[model samples]
Target: MADVAAKERRILVAVDEGDESMHALSWCLSNLISENSKDALLLLYVKPPRAVYSTLDGTGYLFSSDIMAAMDRHGYDVAESVLEKAKRMCKDLHDVKVESIIEDGDPRDVICQMTQRLGVDVLVMGSRGYGLIKRAFLGSVSNHCAQNVKCPVLIVKKPKSTVANN
Candidate 1:
């Protein structure tokens, strides 16, 4: 137990605006992280690349520089908000170090790259609970990372609240 606690580990938790990711972070803190251990909790938020709008396509209106700048700012703001929320969740963790990173790219690719680049011991992320058809069409980030990453991946599925029958 002492050896396990003494070993330093890096655990990456990919987050976004969705409640599922936040739920996964909370679950990771409760079940995987130890208060006394020298663990580094990394909160990663990936901003998708902005769509390229062209006047040649169909729309006569071209995207102005101001519009593009505003869009970029909005993306930055969202990343900050998500990271802040995640940091607040880790406020109680006195021993474990917490770090936040914001990267711009596709979530699936960025997440996989970060895990390997950071040499994470374990990857933690949320399951969106998409159905078979939806998952097939949209693709699953968790599923992709699980198959690609070398480290152990933990996909936390947020349980649906059950209502008691009267």
Candidate 2:
């Protein structure tokens, strides 16, 4: 019974293009996970769906091939870059397992859905560190997930020292 409780945990970390998310990944690896823990880390990146605009004719502005193509290209590039960085961070951890996950939709909804679907033991992410007014107006993803998910949620905030340097 003691061994089972100490067994590796299924940790899911939601990441994005921001440095905050990357920092959370590092925090998770160094703190929650260990060389001996054998924990599995799933790095999730949620991309917003492509823009769809309608004109007076009721046809999608997506008919603008050039504009649509550029938007799609940019989105794909960002998703790839962020996921790559997260994967690179885990390259040195020989004992830990890492999986890259990309989902398309509203980040708050997708993240919550995936957490429950994957049966994650803990959901870890970085807080935007927004002040009260900002979070209230913007409706924070971290806040929403914390309230909805069954698993424990860890919100890593970048330290003041690092913020000062940046």
Candidate 3:
């Protein structure tokens, strides 16, 4: 059989601190991406807008210096940990290229933009599998990306058993 993936496929998987996103990454590793010479997997982690807005924006209120510093530290720590864990997961898959991308913005928008910019063959991500009410209240990143991205979107939902354990 011909090695179809050798044609240079770029698969982008959006990940975060959530277990669901990690599961999606794992799924992509084991199912979609393979040890094809020209294929690449891009793991993207988007840090949402900070809890506190800058005083430069003209807002009279300002977050305390200590609190703001803590927020910065936490964001960096989480990003590094997640990316490292993701990289470790893919280390054994020889011949499959892996890249980590960390961005700061609304994930829904960032994921869509990066997907097109990277010319991704497919955007793989996880769905929180929220009910209609929950999704309506919080919105769904995977759902939004599926609608907006130019590339195909693959949303891997958490298994029922896994969800139950959490």
Q: What is candidate 3's lDDT per residue for 1-166, written digit by digit as tens? A: 9776666788898877777777888888778766665678898988765632243234525667886778778887888898888888888777778899999876788999999999999999889622344344437878798899988889998886775221
Query: Candidate 3 has which clashing residue pairs, if any?
Result: none
Residues 1-166, model 1: lDDT tens digits: 4566686899999988777888889889888887787899999998766642222224425667887788789889988998998899899888899999999876778999999999999999987622343345447878898999999999987777823111
- TM per candidate: 0.84, 0.81, 0.82
Clashes of 1: 0
Please give the range of 10 consecutive residues that has the lowest summed lDDT in model 3: 51-60
Which one is best on TM-score? Answer: 1
- Candidate No. with top lDDT: 1
Question: Can you tell me which runs of candidate 3 are displaced by over 4 Å?
Answer: 52-62, 129-138, 163-166
**lDDT at residue 98 of model 1 (Cα atoms):** 95
In lDDT terms, how accurate is model 1?
0.81
How does candidate 1 fare on TM-score? 0.84
Count of residue pairs whose backbone atoms collide, per candidate:
0, 0, 0
Ranking by lDDT: 1, 2, 3
Q: In lDDT terms, how accurate is model 3?
A: 0.76
